[model samples]
Target: MMEIRMILGLFLMITAASGWNVTFESPTVTVHMHETLSVAFTAIVTEADVANGTVVVSTTRESVASVDDLPVLDSSTVNDLVWSSNLVVSGNFLGNADILLSIVSPDQENKTSDALSVIVIREERIIDTLFTVFVAVMVSIMYINFGAAMDWPLCKRTLKRPIGPTIGFVCQFVWMPLLSYGIGLVLFPDDPELRLGMFFAGVSPAGGASNIWTVILGGNLNLSVTMTTISTLAAFGMMPLWIFTLGSTIFNSANLGVPYSRIAMFAVGLVIPLGIGFLIQKKLPRVSRILVRILKPLCSLLIIAIIVFAIITNLYLFQLFSWRIIVAGIGLPWLGYLFGYLLALVLRQPGPDITAISVETGVQNTGISIFLLRFSLPQPAADLTTIAPVSVAIMTPIPLTILWIVKLIMDRRKKSIAASAEKLQGSTEPIPTVSASTKTDNTENP
Candidate 1:
């Protein structure tokens, strides 16, 4: 019995000698990007063997954060050996990661502590604030410009035919949502945020830029404007319906109770600007024409600004970008363009109407997608998911730009040929003419 008790005591001592516990003043730390945070912690060593242990701190995700070793500030002898120190952490990106602390004893045995959660956030800047406000104001003005250019009679007539708008509606809501969902599933099967982002990008209404492109490419501008208006209005119901249904499935099959009131507010925001534009066109015709003239350039500038600012603000996300993400992004708008064109073609629509539908279908209001993601998801996730719309927005205009260049070249060539024909006609000598008497004298001499 005495020998058995001795062995049990030895085992207990050995077990205790290999065990250590670390406790932080706080279990979780939150830091801003480009900032540092210091956390104080205490390590309790119950055994004499680990009295001179070395502490090492590490983060699970290096991209998210970097943690420094625990610097010992003091040591004390009490019931057991205790060391107190501060763990220094630096935030590198926006996300959540785990911080782990381990102590290595003289015997090279390691004792690891429980994980500590860390969150990194992007600090807001003056430029971000200004950019948000500028986008809001510019979009409103652009819509007003769209209203100025709208032909109310033509819009009504297009509605009477309804084929063009119908095709656009199907393309915008049906084809786009499904395409985005499929692409998200195939490309980012494990990432729910990106999938949600793609889904929102698809479900957003057609932007006013569609109208600009239609006009630039000699499409049915009237129909494009009408479709934009209808699509914006329809989004009030369709967005939520799809969000609660298909969107929910993509997000772990959880029924996401989307904030309906916020969605309503957004819809109202869009409609109010459009209504203001319509009023300006009706009550102030001269101002409307001026707005119309500036619309194209202003919209172009806004597109550039959106791209540049989005890239600048979210530079960190670019690191997470992959070829799959790029493929998914390019697939959304490019496939949308092809699908819309084919659908319209199969329906035997007029060429101009086909162009209008294709443009409206391909170009989504990414601003709205970003807004919805921010509104729906929590911090970090909201910002992270924005990658989807931002990527799509960057890619959406490429094909349109190419088409615009082609149209410009063709127009110049046509003008050159017409000018050459005119010059040749002008330079050609008049056919030699003969008087009746000259002709008779020539005949007699012959």
Candidate 2:
């Protein structure tokens, strides 16, 4: 123990005696992908140290940024015991990494300088802009289909009952935002950008995907559609309200400005298509029915397109996904489902209403969140903040898929059993029954 302590003390003395310091012109540098940047740095050392030591600049994450010059500093670059060298850094990917300066010495001991932070951004291509526009246009068109599917009289009756939609509304706005905030606090306490992303996703309206999930999961399709419409219409106010109030704290922490105009535009976009759909539904019932028939497949296509385009356009973001981010992703929607379900169950909502509310609460309109982030924030941050929303969007459909599969298997088994029973009885009369689970509740009221 004594020898170990003495050796440790000697090593510390040697380290303290090796006086070498490297300082950069800037502590941090932001570069666009495929661009090269020369980072100027100065090192203070003795003549002998410079002669014996080789200065190497490298990045902690080579995938994010690569150092161009291998040996950035050496004796040749040094003058009068002081050396100033340029480390050429090239952005290879879109993310953050640390640039390290090190002095390797065989005669003495090696020393490494403090990290220089690098932020790499991917420039938005024309295709990216076009893709965003495409998403917006497609979503608006899908809302027309949404509108065609709405039964105004049934909507009015559902409103009269008001239990399911009311619960959905509260869950979507109240519980979701608060839950996301809490999750961000717990999971990513130091990352204000991620917290803001989660908050933005939380406050956004219910997605059209929720209605599709409801249809597949044998939920109240009427309630799901009605809630989706109501929540979207409400986003014009609710989103802004949340963003200005509690969301303001996160925005301030992240040094982000709330884009009030863009949000209002998003709400307006939803309303216009929906209004046209309603007109078509009421005036041209036949056309509305035709659109309604195609609505499911069209919505599925839209969902696929959104996910595929988002992934393709921001392929770099997948690299940013960490365990904490993944947990935040999975937790947000699943917790929303739990909260919505428990709330409705506590209120004695019928089974179908419970499913509808749960689906509505869990599935957020991440399109709005992504759109707002991309348009509102500048490059890099626009991409960075998107991680949270994209994560949630990707994770949101997983459980629904599993549930749908299980439900399909169970439904098939039940049908098979019914067929066997009919065969056993040797009856020619066919069984008058509904085999599929996608039935709407006869009573909209609790």
Candidate 3:
């Protein structure tokens, strides 16, 4: 019966894919004239009974524009894939346009792969590019600002304290990932995109922002820094392993099979950059400092740009499925944090330690998840693309917000305690006194 049900499900999916329906990972994109855009397309083949399959993709300007006015752009096909010939658009085609991509398989009677639609808007506004750059800068700034403090000799000494480094490492690698898995399981059981996002979050090591959180929470800053370093290094291996394992499981459950090579590619993309950065940092401290500074801001800008692009592209998804997604996004992070804090508490750790663990466990690497979804999954890339940003936008802010709230409360408490102590000190001070002889004379004479 189970096997039969699985067969039925597969049949239904194939049926859904064969029609002339339009699907887009991102419905709209903002681009400048001469700017290049890349879009992914898929064709699902259902029936084994047909022949002569071919797919054609074309774009039509919204206006009744002339072919000459449409700009003489070129297109190319690579293995069943079609893409814009150049990364840059040289045409004057501006405003909204419909990009039509079709797949026709000769041997198959029905082909039902979900088609991804990408829009090309021609303009010279540098907003998205600038935003991407800004995100990168912010990320670099975070790393440098926090990373410098970790270099101090005293910080190194403090890191060697009893179980400090061990605990920190555990929080960075083991506890946080496990906690993220638990959160994903609970909050996004039905949504593959959300689940994948959570899985990515679980696998990602704490970035530099963690160091700041540790200091603010009164945990050993040195320990946090050390943990972040170790985790970031270990991520080259662990991140891929965790993603492959968890992603395979999640995709399998969702009837999508992910290939091992795809997983390898993702790991390589992530780790190579990280490894290069680490090597530069180790080999040339001065150069590394400069790179880190540049990269931090660049990373921040990239993150924001990616997020904005994602949101803009999937505007329809957000509008259509707003309530369900919003709830999952808001609830999942909180649940993750709660679990992390509980885990820390159970271990009998300090409040700051607990806070660190909570944030690390709850905050995930949404970017990595997006990459995997875009490149690795067997399902239509468009679905993954749309889902990726939605999931990240929903999940990323949760931990950051929670951490901020925790910081505020901690700050207020510290101030209140200081004020109370000052008041007590003032009340208990001794009054001024006259000399002993003067006092005695006054008393006796009187």
Candidate 4:
């Protein structure tokens, strides 16, 4: 019979000032989806607490927690509130969410609640599970199609080439993740989810489009395919390991709700499609080519649709940011590009190898990133987490697309010039050679 709000509580503390002190009389709260919940707390103010103050509340994720019946503060007293599901989480949220409570003064001085955590538990939704499974299946097919176009002969040829994969693996697994972590510190030092989001972006495998871009950019297709395979396979081991390792260091171990098991399952799942593609290539080249042609366009359409769906569903989260996070958000991918290309160049690799490694390094598996972020983590975080990868997904392709276009133009111009020169030579008339007798007669006449 009252207002409903969605609550995702990820606590962010605004450290206390010498002023007023506020504490939750009851440190922990538990609530359910439909029923109402209540919380009790007390606050005290002294002359030392100089400024007017209000309670600050936030969920761990992007959205604010939905609390109803908030009490008015008097310098020293107990207050109570009955919480109802907010419009956002009214029927959708599940899991234990930590609700951050802080007192914000006029001057921005604040104090955090010593203890407050909300654990909202719900059963798994069948619809959500089905949708996730559908997406996983689609991803498998997309990778299979990706593998179909792979130049196997070239893959074998480059299999022994140590330099290219060395450069690529270093950039993909080592450099980008480290850079993402650093940027997360600079930009979202206070926000664990944002920082973790960046870390995941770094750890995501190179997308299907990386191989596509490599071919378009006149890079070695063999190396591109090889790198994608290696990284995809490596992700099974690395993604979960990185999530566990980085989760502890970057955020207080409490804040990170990493679905390590889910990540491992998904990473391992990729091998199925990869092996299928290998079989197709080995058994029937003609069918593989047809599947590649068909799947390429189809997979692209599916990817675009999925991206659009994710953005639209979580558009509100993206709106709640200043240009600071946006720049920090978008900056990660560009940094990957600059650093990857430079790393490859520094290794003294050939031009084609450099281009292939650079593209593979910069372009992450945005589809998988979006999917995992959406389904793996709890809500609000999932929505907020997609921002960096979505930005990367949109921005990373521009350079490769432009390079491909420029290469096409240059190739056409070269062909035109060569044809022109050939035509001119063919059209030229040879100078008539003067016979010896004719030359002698002409000299005598003169």
- Rank candidates, lDDT, best first: 2, 1, 4, 3
Give lDDT per model, in order.
Answer: 0.77, 0.80, 0.51, 0.66
Clashes of each: 0, 0, 40, 16
Q: After superposition, how far is residue 298 of candidate 3 from its true place, in Å?
A: 6.0
Model 2 ranges off by over 4 Å: 1-29, 40-87, 95-118, 275-286, 422-446
Task: Tell me the tens digit of each residue's lDDT in model 1 across 269-385.
Answer: 766777888898899999988887777677667766765776787787887788977987899999999999999999999999899999999999887777667655655766778
For candidate 2, write residues 1-446 as lDDT tens digits.
42343343334434543435878899989998989998888888766666676655555567778776554456677888788878888998776778766665678776667778888988768988887798788778878888887767777978998878889989998999899889988987767778888888888888877888998898998898789878977887898889879987887776667777766676676788989998999999999999988886787677668767887887777777999899999999999998999999999999999999999999987877887777677667677788898899889989889999999999999999999998888866676886344344434433
Best by lDDT: 2
- Clash count for candidate 1 is 0
RMSD of each: 8.2, 11.8, 12.3, 7.3
Top-TM-score candidate index:
1
Clash pairs of candidate 2? none
Candidate numbers, best TM-score first, in rank order: 1, 2, 4, 3
| Cα error, candidate 1, residue 2 (Å) | 48
**Candidate 4 positional error at 227, Å:** 1.6
Model 1 RMSD, rounded to 1 decimal: 8.2
Q: What does the lDDT read for residue 219 in candidate 1? A: 96
Clashes of 3: 40
**Model 3: per-residue Cα lDDT over 1-446, one tens digit each:** 42343343345444545564433445544454345554333223322211344433333432211111111112223323322222222233332343443444555443333422333333423753453444444344434433432344554675566354565566556665676566567766755555665566556666444455455556655556566666655776887777667657876765555667766765555544455555666677887677645543454455555566657644544433555455555554555556667767887877766766665555554544454454554322334334533564466565675667887998899999999999999899698879999989999998
